[model samples]
Target: MNAGEEPGVVAMDVESTHMPTNSEEFVDAPNFDLETYISRYEGFSKIQRLQYIARRCPRLKNDAYRLAIKDLKEGCNTASYKEIMATVGDSLGPGYGYDAAWCEAEDRKAAAARERLELELNQFKTNLIKESIRMGYHELGRHHAARGDLAAAFKCFVRTRDYCTTGRHSAE
Candidate 1:
């Protein structure tokens, strides 16, 4: 209780509270392995987790970004790749494995694959084959997951349950 203050109130000492601005202050695990750590996650989560780690740990930024770039090459998440590249542009310097040509090529390939899968799914639906329809939905879900579209992947995968013909299909 201080002068002119409420009887039940206490003045707060703002300076006594500590907040860390530097990432180095949070680096407690010096032996952290980014690869092993990221292996537990899949799809979009893997890239997101890596980006989070990169932002929080300056020492691991380069390694995290490098691994993220490698993962991006296998998926159709060009926007993520570009965003990550821009975030680490100054820190990573030039020629840090960013390829515009590869992005364009990968986008084309992904689009073509999506079109083919959708066409197959439509054919299966038209034929009224339960097994084929389920399989078609499963394949489309996988394709969407690989392209980093988690919402679409979840919807496609959920549709498979409606056409599941057996306990095994349901389990899968």
Candidate 2:
């Protein structure tokens, strides 16, 4: 970090996503700009992003489901959600299934959790897009899709598509 040192790269130890608070880092970190990073780094594609999430959330059942669903929606050739869910069930180990009442209750709880997680993910994606777009030039949609933030990603993709079509007509 010393000046006149040719700005040598400093290696910082980023915390691993395996820890419980690792996911929270994505939310709390100010530099977690989905759009900016993706637009800047050509190496981080949609497939790579999904793979990263799969690696990071290996045991987290719902995370895999969410990641797979987002990847499929974003035109990724990833394994289907059912496949991921089956693996998740196996990861959950034996005797994970419950009887009728318990199953119903768990389903309800899962549905609620999914809804909440989707809302939060979309909100984060939206915020990043809005912020990055205001800076102009870079596309904000790709990062959302890459990170499995499907709702916001889809919204941004549609907007980008519409903008392009509108420009084409205006140019004509």
Q: For this target, which candidate reaches the highest TM-score against the unseen true structure?
A: 1
- Report the number of the highest-lDDT candidate: 1
Cα lDDT tens digits, model 2, 70-148, are 4444343222333444555544334332124543454465456556655654665577654333222113455444444
Alpha-carbon runs more than 4 Å astray in model 2: 1-138, 165-172
Candidate 1 positional error at 119, Å: 0.5
lDDT of 1 by residue, 1-172 (tens): 5678988776888999788776444454579988999999876899999988987787898888988888887778887888897787756656575688988998899899999999999999999999999999999999888877789999999999999989999999
Q: How accurate locally, in lDDT, is each candidate?
A: 0.87, 0.44
- Record all residue pairs in model 2 with backbone atoms less than 3 Å apart, i.e. clashing: none
Error of model 1, residue 51, in angstroms: 1.3
Give lDDT: candidate 1, residue 81: 89
List the candidates' TM-scores in order: 0.76, 0.22
**Deviation (Å) of 147 in candidate 2:** 1.3
- Regions more than 4 Å wrong, model 1: 1-25, 39-42
Clashes of each: 0, 0
TM-score for candidate 2, please give it. 0.22
